[model samples]
Target: MLYIFDLGNVIVDIDFNRVMGVWSDLSRVPLANLQNSFVMGEAFHRHERGQITDEEFAAAVCDEMGMALSFDQFAAGWQAVFVALRPEVIAVMKQLREKGHRVVVLSNTNRLHTNFWPGEYPEIAEAADKIYLSQEMGTRKPEPEIYLKLLQEEGTPADRAIFFDDNADNIKGAQQVGITSILVTGKETIPAYFANNPC
Candidate 1:
């Protein structure tokens, strides 16, 4: 079996509120307004798709939010989203590997985030046999092409793989590709699945 997992919110905890809080302090934009303006719009998607530079994304965000912060300040707020490692999910992944199942991570993330987290959450990266990033792959989640590409590259059949992600659309996308997918809502997600499925 090939066990696929999403990086943020699954193997590692992420809080967009953390980003909001930091940016709010820097931009003085009020949390609510900042949250409202921080839409995952075209520019955000493009950044994750490796179609734009980090500075471009920062400028787009700044323009949309009416912020005058420099790129360094923006990057700090962006990196604040990551909180810590999800040890429970990491344990399950390790067990899955011991059971002879291959594991990998599929995340829709940008270079800034990609460059930052691995060092802090090295175990999460090490737990997986390989990590797949949307920015590096030039494709993001909820896309059929990325799923097809991952499966082909890993030489894993759709039916033989099970994917866990926090996003509904991403879950649906994996299901559309004929891979069993679980929506991770809380800590019990990965553990409960492993308890019942044992794979």
Candidate 2:
């Protein structure tokens, strides 16, 4: 069986509040305002969909927040959101691999995150058979196209694959594509799910 996992808040810890805090401190923009203007903005969606370049996204964020941070500075603050890998999840993935299950990462993330986390957590990069990112795929989760793309690229039938993600919508997307899916709620739930399901 094939096992597909989501990156943020699933295999790894991520805090958008941290990103907001860093940007807030650097730009002097109120957290709520930043969240509203940038986090919930079209620029972010465009960037995640690979519709815009990193420089364009950074510039848009800076213009929206009225900050003057350079591209490198903005990227630094943006990449600060990832905390660490959830070791238990990594262990589960390793166990799955040992048992001969194919494991892969599917995340609705931009280039900055994709570039940063793998380097920061080499174990995550090493754990997966392949990693699929939204920016590279030109599609994001909760969208059937990306799920279909993954199945097509991997030559895995949807019925033979299992997907785990923290978002209900993403899980629904997988289900829509006819893949078995689990809605991961917390770190402990992963091992419990594995124990009950047994791949």
In lDDT terms, which candidate is top? 1
- Writing each residue's lDDT as its tens digit, candidate 2 over 1-199 gives 8899999899998888888888888778788887776554788878989999999999998998777788987998899889888999989888899999899999988988877787889998778889899898998888899999999999999999999999999999899989999998888778999888886
Off by over 4 Å in 2: none
Model 2: which residue pairs collide?
none
Count residue pairs with overlapping backbones in model 1: 0
Best by TM-score: 1
Give candidates' CA RMSD values in order: 0.8, 1.6
Cα misplacement distance, residue 186 of candidate 2 (Å) = 1.1
Error of 2 at 142 (Å): 1.3
lDDT scores of the candidates, listed in order: 0.92, 0.88
lDDT of 1 by residue, 1-199 (tens): 9989999889889999999998899988899999888899999999999999999999998999988889999999999999888898888888888888899999999999988998888898778899999998898999988999999999989999889999999999999999999999997888988788764
Look at candidate 1 and tell me the lDDT of residue 162: 89
Assess the local accuracy of residue 181 in candidate 2 as a C-alpha lDDT between 0 and 100: 94
